[model samples]
Target: MRILQLHVDFVEYLPVKKEIDDAEPLLKNEKELIEDTVVILTSIENGDDETLIEDFVKETLDYLKKIKCNSVLIYPYAHLSSSLEAPKSAFKLMTQLEDALRASTDTIVVRRAPFGWTKELGIKVKGHPLSENSRAIVKKNTERQPGTLVEVVSSKSDAIDNEGSVSSALAAEKDLKSNWYVLTVEGALIPYDGYKFKKSEINLENLFKYEILRKRTVEDQPPHVKLMRKLGLADYEPASDSGNMRFYPKGRLIKSLLEQFVTKKVSQYGGLEVETPIMYDSHHPSMESYFNRFPARQYNIKSDQKDLFLRFAACFGQFLMTKDFQISYKNLPLKLYELTRYSFRREKSGELVGLRRLRAFSMPDCHAFCQDINQAKIEFLKRLDLSVSVMEEIGITPEKDLEMAIRFTKEFYTNNKEFVQNLVSKIGKPVLVEMWDDRFFYFVLKWEFNFLDNSGKASALATDQIDIENGERYGITFIDESGNKKNPIILHNSPSGAIERVIFALLEKSAKMMKEGKTPYLPLWLMNTQVRIIPVRDEFIPKCAELLDQLKTNSIRADIDDREDTLSKKIREAETEWIHYTVIIGEKEVATNSISVRDRLKKSSYSTSIDELVKLIKEPMKGKPDLPINLPEYLSKRPRIAS
Candidate 1:
């Protein structure tokens, strides 16, 4: 069966003459829905049975939930397929589908278009990403095709993938077996069954592994989600579709900082920055074939009567841009960068969370073209270092905030084992390495920096992939020393993964601190209000104003707490906002020409001069980008946010 799903603002239809003699009776001559709903354009194919109708309803409702559509309209769209069922069969299937949809879901409204009738449709699709998708659902136990793909395993041990069932995906693994061992901290390979775990490392053995979709046992409201909403950072948009969050002022500030920071790092590494379109024609010859090579699903739209798919990454734009560029071996390592406004992936409803994974999220994508395999490996290692540095800059150290994982094809590893060992040695941790006996997609080797939260959820923060196919696929070539045009190897890296996921990790880390009975705080540079001055009484307001002015002049984020609240209450409020420094000024401090500075992060207080405080804060903030405070300069002018 063929289906196209649409999350529409409204859809209007009017029935016309029946084209077939077995047409089902119409309940209404005209019908329309005024608000959010799902319009399923369905075609019952030649061999469809009652079981097909059952499966179709289940899948249809699943897509509806992802877009938050409760009501559904099952429109008989015979034009979607050329091999349609007989008119009688199609009519019966339509009736059965309508009844099944109502029975399977608690949602009250379910309607179907009059079968065998020509109808006019007026549809206004929602503006949000993932608002529409094209799907092809085949019956169970379909015939499988043969293909050759490489698979490799680290000589030591193998990782279990509950979500992907990698073992099954690679047919070659069926008859072959080897001794699996897990690598230790010192890079020693030990038998997986013989390895012992430390008390602190026990949970790593039982962690649930998934690539994109979230597991069923994942907590509904993890610590980060609660804290994010409470701090007025980001929240869900009920008016928009699910997985597309609405960021408040503070959240936007956080996202912007991370984006700018990573982009600057990429630029400093000799990257040529550019922007690209978000949509491309789905029927473009090369793109159509390229889409099949990718393992991701896409959001499809019919624009001006032409089929188009949203770009899942910066690949399509960058590849298309490079296709027509003039180049030489001298510029072999040509780097391209773009901070994607948003990328859309039709993730399952069960997988959508606060920010760990989203249907629409900002990403900093950088790609480089290398002259040969050697140059590509050189660039790959540099990106790996940058990935570590980015995590460290964000306060996620290798030992504390993140873990490492490397995947490579067996052919590549056999040829260059030393290079892989060097990476593991440099990081000085037990890295999880997976070897594939065959090639799965375009990349030969890839690695990720992951953050595992208390809920046993592991999220990849930074990643670099070595792509071996796209250069030729997109006709991107550079002239070599011999004057012959050669396709270049491409490297894809996100110094930091999705901007939202970075924020998610930061929030989750802070919450973990709170769980351990420690005060949680945002990174110093990201604090919305770095320093807040509180006057003990109305008379000391002038002193507070002077200090705030001096601090701002020195490029320190400072604000005056001018609200009519008690001194104790104000101090508590600053801490709650995760303000890095809170200063309480009074007669004694004003006369002494000093202030008592309360450090929310250090959980301590000390007497210091305005000059001394500025110098101290500057030490930790050196070389870091500064973002404007989303809140007002004076507390009195601001309204309460984040209930």
Candidate 2:
């Protein structure tokens, strides 16, 4: 059983609908309000029985006494656990638990929200640290043997995270202390507070505040969330778990292009692309230890009495694969890349926003195995350049759209100060520095490029980590020149982070432009419809089709606006879709064998030949993937997916 306990000023709930066939009949389906109560949002999980009732009551009474509250309300909430008990059994247990709580203390009043009913909930929890807490109540095993398998769920909200297993690194990270600095291009580490900011350094300063203070909980949805839906990119999937999204056709096309581009860049950087499984055995020796090494809540599953877990990164599979291969130092600096279609991380419900953070996302992960630290350093810089180039080609420039942050232990900085300074000099800007007193994670040095949104939240994009562990942990060995087997140092690099986050950054950047009273636009290559060809008259429909054919021949995504609407309205709709160029076909254009084109970005219109229009559109698309339009060629045939 899992429970999220909240001490609220008042909890107001109304039964809106019955979610289960065995839903309890309510005396009154009106709003039920409880004041000055300890509300326990409960999820009854498998294997829970009367054995847990005593402990549950004891915990509840202790909490009430601690808070000096005499009132309690039990609310059945299903989202707290993926593994749920049967509805009938769960309802009975919930009622029995409530009865036990009431029978325990004469001075306390106990109430329960109707079970198995869909209800509208309103809660105002107090702002104290003890006001919110979660717990997983399991049947205690007194007769457990040595070396027996035991499943333990965590209770840390800010550290190890959630009910699932958390990494030891993440838990240590919570208590890790660091001194902040701004590393300049001239190789001086100025204290963060001592460094003065320039007008152009606003984003960097925002990144400092976001990282140093570590305020990641988002209060309101960012501007990109609305724009994502308004532009037909993606939306939250209500049918699935929170933080999982459904992408429309246009969004799919954009994601495909980005995945293709990032893969191509990695391949050119000597990475050998490979595929890996989405799930692994949690009881496996390597997985068991590695779980606490990297911090994230995982989705656990039970199959045939064996414990399994969904992967949050491509590291496990890739490392296991490399461990089985016979390699030598000649093959050192071996790079393996995988573009994971879906990596699962059970993020906190409160932090699950649009595409910025997700439970499942596509990640372009690449790992390089090196002979030693020197080789690792060389490969790290190469991957950094590759990441920078990839971002630049994707229209997100490092100097303008991103801020650099490098984190390391004090020992690393003291030993390799010049190497760290070179990284800042390479980016040609002052970077945020976090120098830890001790090493906690597998990586001794790490850096990432962050994009600051309008709400001052920093989202990491391109990143690389110089990991000194995991090789030996996974038992991967490469024969050295002296014929001795040695573990290789691994480097983890994600050139563009999650594909969904790239889209979020693009949308956020456009929203930022709109906020500045500038025209908002997507990169031409990413636009679903690069050009829209509209017919001025019914006779011009045939002419517009011919022009579209020409545009298609040159690999331009052009669509015909053949609907029976005024030419002005058609053009306005095209503008709303952010079509780069709108071509209108009419008598003047037909007679002269030319087209009247409206450029959305330039806000200019002029007559140009079909060849010139093709060249104009194709110029900026140089070296980029040429994908056909995702929607139909005629606008009239396309369904409205976005508002």
Candidate 3:
């Protein structure tokens, strides 16, 4: 399976509001046109009144319909501090706006915000009496006390001692400085005095300054900044090493191991490994459509009066390759894999973090074409098995270290809930299903393989999907035994999304495990430097060199540590690099023609001969290691495997 990094612009519909005393004249005036259109609303507040809110919303819907927009997304700006107290009229306006839009036009689609945003907005409204019957259920649930209310008990005469009496009487106070009570009704401790009652008045300014409002407002800033930061575009650093040699020696070793793993595993699965140009003609019909669909992710290049775009996915190239060859039923289940890098877009400036989201990164992309529906299912399952096997080799166990697929509900197509439900049902159970608001209708099944971090949060490591739309769009077809051609079912599956991302996950996971005094278990074969031959003394240097030579002959990733450092320090360094085995050459072992071997995790030593050590390492190396690694043999020898 090939991995991919796609930049997507999360388009949202925002309801705009403009208050005009003369509604009829404003509608006829072109200057008022700016106010009526829904071009991404900003600075929405809770306390906005009814008529102005309704008029703005109605005009925005009309403008959206006029523009022929298929989807109208209600993007909540509640993350902004200004949106804290959206006028009640805004809610009432939206209640009638949907039906009003439906009455006017059937073309435009509408949808609510993502659950994450919805949940956040709900939290903001907690303990708010004005927000008591708020549609946001999360906010209502968090309300401190629904029936209990707070009232202000203003000071009258200086001798009254109102502060002491109020504190003792009320369950809670809105503000201690300004006389306010948790209980709106007067109690025994603080009787309702005519002077204090007369002084108290319910006004918008005081209501907004309420303690609950202040607390919620203050708490909202950090999380909003964090979310915004996460949505920013990724940043790229120039390659420091010349000719891709900028990588540290250890990093190079790791890269080599990953390449080896991918070559062997993908080749074994009958996947035709290929490479394609990173840039493509922007005018190409397929690419043009893709750009329109995900503008934020695709990069455009101008040359010779023409536009070119960085290829966001390898599937298009693979599909284009298939057009050159005529295939029959016998040649069914064709799988194509490529290790390529492409540029993807990001919406926020701070979203980019290390290798997780990058403008350019390498992915192992596999596109499979099958003649029959069952064949497609079988291929997907096989891909899933391979993905799991690879991750396991790298010490990622499905049930323990990793959680494969998580399914959750998301608001689907705005206007066509039934269509979305029908589509989801037909696609079958996704490995990890979450209700996604921004997904295409044509793709049925979508599954993502996730790796749990130290915090137990799942990060997507790989993805698999069945695309029925792209097949028709790209005109990919196969000829059957009856000589009839039909559009082939296409499966876009990536076992490892990006090499940089997988490396990041491995680094984080390994570092955490080591900090906890745990040795990271890696499949013997995928280890960057499989064996580290450490000479106990200068006398054993020759023996170590000889052992290293023997290992190299057997294609074992072995190295010699001839550093002047102590054996213990050398061993510690080797362990830090996560080398699989450490072979220590001491006087006794050299004399006996055996070396003391220490496993990275065990940290316990045992004696083994040169031949025996090679044999031992060879066993695990015979099969594919879990994770994406490159085996030298596969690269040097392009085995003519059938797909």
Candidate 4:
């Protein structure tokens, strides 16, 4: 079955004549109009039978919910498919689809056009990002030719074909035997299905549905997609691969600051920063072994008759480097850190949406080589704190903005129950726990903080893993005090999962605020233009420039709206741009040497001296990295990058 779904403002159709002998009886020959309806132009192809009714209805209902409309028009359009079902059979399935849809939802109004008829159709589709979609629904075929493409039914309403090489761990991830539980801070292990949730534990429940249940309803692009483009942060790069993004100047500035901040934080915690090549030889023994151990797809390249693949994480490079080092128990816990500028992961195409998930991303990967499990546990806690602190500094509060999930081998949890409980206690909440019967990957234990977005989807943010096999697998060893060389335990930590994902979380958070009738603004420290200076008249442009100079001298990012627009329009533009403070200069301000300021966050206007405004902006930015404005200081000189 094939369908073209559309959200239309109004659709009109007229049954002129019957195109087939099995056409349905028409009650009216006049034109019919339905306003604000979901139009599904469906085609029932050969082999499409009664089995498709349930899925078709469910997909229609999901689409209705996403578009916030209750009316649906299921039109039987034969042009959608080349090989159509027999007219009599197609009519029966079409009506069955209509009946199933109406029975599934009480509020939904389902309507259908006459099957096997030539009709004049008119539709004015909605202009939003998710107004139109195409889907192909087909039955499973167990047998196929050698070169045939594999078609996988998407978890969402649509269908997608699987591509790229699947790693052993990635395949194991789909079939990993696990028991799910909710581990409370008080050390109670409640079955995930039986645990009672509090009203405040909505995000926890969402994490359960995302991880254990594997349920996703919102198929359209997330709220952050629109916000990313509107706010001029980032956008899809059509010239590149699906998951690669083109960051605007503001986006680059934000990315740069986050990189600096995270690197500084890791260094403060005793991590020796290092650099590594972004690509590695695919035929290398260690690379080939490690690829199957990790659950990620690689971007393969052929260079000079040698096969090379992009690195998905810093672990391989750091592990290979450490394998060559000579160390003793005296240097038990050696930490190496790298802020990978472009870690490449060939994520499923359907999963590529804005900055939430990207093919190329910056990851702050830190590895700690430990002598034993005991040492690894202690370092893990410290790094967990570091993760929490880093996210908090980035304006994503843990336990509020993030939900904790801990995955471990059942044997590890059995021997180290207190250690596992300590982690939940540190989070101060009941966390989702997945315990496997056996270790499928190198990590014996791993925990991550996930941000549940406005949609029901959850994305992992800060994560760390305690790898018990990687050191031995890579031949990285340390000599103990007893003079025996042994493989050291490796702990992989990404304090901030990926810099691009952090921006996505911030934008998604802002979208939530907007939905709740609040003035959404970025963190003051991350704003590209901390303060926007607007001259009320052309004569006051010099005064605005002086104010900009003063702000620059104080290390505050300030830009002048020196365009020829009216004062109100300039102020509105500043607010739309999410500028933290808008300082309006005119005769009154020039006469008094004070400025009128509009704080976008506060949504109020006040008068303050330039020194006072500078101090106000600087206070919140004390510990954050500062960078000059990435765009032109004057508004007139700037190009319109975002619509």
Candidate 5:
């Protein structure tokens, strides 16, 4: 926001014809309007926000106080800056500036002329050092200014963000926005070449070369959503609000598998499963405070004259549970976890696309209460590993599929430098860092594992925040060795960030493969039909059924393409569904006790026995829970998700 302050002896301005569509409806009569006032030429820019208005007004009042002036006139002049905001946004800002000026006790009368109109002005200049002064206010660097007053209520998360985007960009890539970090796997912050990452052949690195920035528009659908609809996984439901997606049988099955896997992983990491209310009193002091602290938007509900907000995450739920628990230092690092099926976040309409961004999602929220910062670090590392393992199990290769980002306060960096360095070392990659001078949230440090999608916009898949404030806010305390009440350092973790987004990421990964002339498919365990058994003729139908039963008995998700379609058409349909393996049976195969297998991943066909095929599918799926195929076993019985 740029402001040109002209401490004039007298200024007169008359509004002329509108130059823009959003120009204020004001007419200049035959008589010219004149005023003896100090004129303020304001230019609001793209990045100006709600907090900016408060800060600007405070600064303007200070200038007014210094110059011993109480009357001021605001003039919206776009020529003060080349980078002007949208006309609507600028008009709103000018009104806010005027309102704030009027609210101040220091101002006798404050007024703003009509905005977005050509104006004829005459002014008598006052020649003094303070008479003509220009000020450039940048939202980014405002944090450094001690006197700058920012509205924490409106700009809670915005205060820490680089732009409107929350994710950090890659540090090495200039085109990407990222956080800074000191990564150390070998006990110190090391360079990228110091240790080799366990990079998979995901071939995701080349995506960064394209500089695929975000196109934030509601009409532009993500590529993964199209594929998701095609695969009968999920699609947007018109009955629900935007960002609310309905999962078909296949999509729900995929979501369930991920949910079950993440839940078990959290349990293994010492988290005790807990469930909390879906809605809480909005008037609750603690609830309201925490609402402002967290970055997510909320859905408000009015029931029986009481206002309530839907749960955005499990923070309040788990925290409220801990507040009632009779915990000791021995149970200090108590992990409470929940897999919320319908967690709600009011994401903007333009930001909602497929599962990548959703208003309603299944969030796996885990909070670990530690005795101290040291114990919290230990638990944080454990949750981080759990997140990485879940990703790898779901076929998303770490470092290849996701990037890590860390944000902390200067206090944490100064006091616990080695601890943070140890984290980077374990990950073996440099992470983006967002540093704050003062502590904002409960946690001094927080990290997110980000998934960059096909559209080049990254989403936080797995995230953990070290909260130092919530324990005290909720009165959640543990008995110390001295039997005294002590606030436990809370670790807010979502090991698998959101269930839908994981599916989205997997879809995006497959999309990337297809773009590179490779077959696109979900993981075999998560697919609606892992294997399709096809018969050569009607006589072979019984043989195909026999094979399907055998495969299903071995826990393989198998189906039969029993539609009376041509053999070529059936094979084409199987290929399109991305069925991992296609088995064809005929007189030759039945006599020889062998089946011709078309391997989608290998892009090759070979004859293999039923026993060999089961072994191949089960090996990779070992130890992973499988969801039953939600679609009909026979293709003829199933309806098409996409035309």
Candidate 6:
């Protein structure tokens, strides 16, 4: 988390001095400030006098100390884009700075570019000019001298001892077009240039000592640690990267179910499925405008030469895709749905809870383009119905388990109060509402979906926004049969805020319920392993296998436990994994052609035929269920205000 701000300027001293003054306030009383500034001088690219360069370095150091600033970052910015073969001045300056800083402070951390005798011995150069040439040399050399391209080395010997034997062994490799070698050091092989014999380690520990990485261990672990552990991810450590854990097996199961659910529901409702990129140029009106208001949540990519950012919402992209396409009044309400990944900003480090506030996560995002206010309301109700249906299918009940609503307040409805009122009336509920003050901004009308956690705390699970501002910003328009151009009202909605968050909530809720002597009852569809066939004793193994085969043939998620563990242990493991049902087959059941079923939540067992069990599970899903209306009439009638 440590961030180092370097100051490298040889042209002016006054601005450099001012920059220090500005940066000091940001670090004051926060991080340890180094004591003495170090200055380094080097010969110019054109072989200019070394004495003059040395004089400038000494003067700069003196000036820095006079201003009560310590710790200097020296970089020869002049030589970076030069045509000279080698800038000796830059090298000399670096060496002098390193020595001076070390002498002045015991905790001095020096930063330097990677360099080695061969290109292959240093760190990989991303987008480096000499990378192609270096790669060709390493390829040729490794082919000719196989032993020289060492893949593994003893970490203790190479890093701790800094043995020259390892370097020499790497140097003896065959030469290709370029003079570069790959060295196996500290059990970590790095590519380096042939001109330098050694490359310095990044020294991240020491470098970050004065900044964010200082003073704490357990508290400093990144947010992703718990998430990574939960996902059982071992390939890439979550310590340094920004992305959600894509558990292939579990993710595949969840995604398949969601896709099937959405496809069936959307098709039945006459909605269309759309897909878009995960990242987009930040110049998109939605982003530019959003950043203007909430700069903290926006991320920018300087390397792309365009304002590129990870998309936080999918509606903008979907709107862009449909913008230019000709649409008549007949296409009054076109609903588009997409299950996509998005990223959002979490203000503080502690705000990042497992899957709750990830830098990257996926959601079931949808947008409805409506011709009129009434059409928008119709689409909104349909979306509400779908959200409740999906949640119930996944074992979340509205009355006892979930409470959600369309948010209406002064902040969200200041500009379009009437529109918000219409939405609230149509949805027929306001169980969860956040009254806005004068400070609230953006969107004329917005709906927030919430769920009650085990702690009785309500967490917003999703939102649907009537974005008049964004529609105006993007100029999304539709044409009537009379040729009148009208702005299409945009409904920005997500059924689930994030799949990871929902999963985390579910896990916590289940754990709490189990602790309170309740079973984790999953609806028929959402179970990972819907059914588990457990043999009561070794004698019932054959009958259990036969039942498992039948369940699998019926496309029901089912598994057989034929392990050596006791039946209790097997049942416990199944419950831990959140299996929906545990079917126990014993000698009596085997002989009777029946099975004892243990409901996950009920903690009770009953005898039933296999066919009867299937019928019981499928009974609740006989038809499309209506959205639950649990709100008091007074709350439902509350007027919505404009943003």
Which of the numbered candidates is closest to the native, going by highest lDDT? 2
Off by over 4 Å in 2: 1-175, 214-219
lDDT score, candidate 3, position 181? 22
lDDT of 3 by residue, 404-462 (tens): 33222243223433433433343232122233333333455565655544433345676
Q: Write the residue-wise lDDT of candidate 2 on 1-643 in tens digits.
A: 8786778788899999999999999999799988889989899998789888987998888889999889999999887777899999999999999999989989999999999999988876654546766776777774253322232233343332222322344335434678899999999899999999899998998888887776544557799899988889899889999988999999999999999989988998999999999999887888867754543377778999887888999998999999999999999889999999899998878878889999999999999999999999888889889999999999999989999999999999999888897788889999999999888778899999999987889999999999888999999999999999999999999999999999999999999999999999999999989999898888988888887788888998989989889999998898888888998888899889888989999999999888888888889898788789999998889898997
lDDT of each: 0.77, 0.87, 0.50, 0.85, 0.75, 0.49
Q: Least lDDT summed over 10 consecutive residues: which range in candidate 5?
A: 162-171
Query: Against the hidden true structure, what lDDT does model 5 obtain?
Result: 0.75
Q: How much is the lDDT of residue 332 in candidate 3?
A: 82
Off by over 4 Å in 1: 1-181, 184-194, 199-218
User: Which lDDT tens digits does candidate 1 get at residues 1-643?
Assistant: 6776667777777777887888777777766545677878888888776766766776787777777778888888876566888888777877888898888877648877778887767766564545656555556654242311111221211111111211222233222343334455565655445667556554334322332233434565788988899888999998987889999878888888888888888888877899999988877767855744442356777888988878789987999999899989998799999989898886767778888889888988999999999999888888888878878887778766776777788788779877787777777766666666777558888888778876778888888888999999899999999999999999999998999999999999998899899888888888778889999998899988888888888888888988898998998888778888999999889889999999877779999888889998888887788766777888899887787
What lDDT score is found at residue 440 in candidate 1? 58
Write the number of the candidate with greater TM-score, choosing between 1 and 4.
Answer: 4
Q: How far is candidate 6 from the true structure (C-alpha RMSD, Å)?
A: 21.9
Segments of candidate 5 deviating more than 4 angstroms: 1-220, 292-296
- Name the better of 2 and 5 by TM-score: 2
Candidate 6 residue-wise lDDT, 472-586, digit = tens: 6677778877899887787877665676666655665665565687764435564546677788877777787788777766556666777677878988877765666889988
Q: Which ten residues in a row have the lowest lDDT in candidate 1?
A: 156-165
Where is model 6 poorest over a 10-residue stretch in terms of lDDT? 156-165
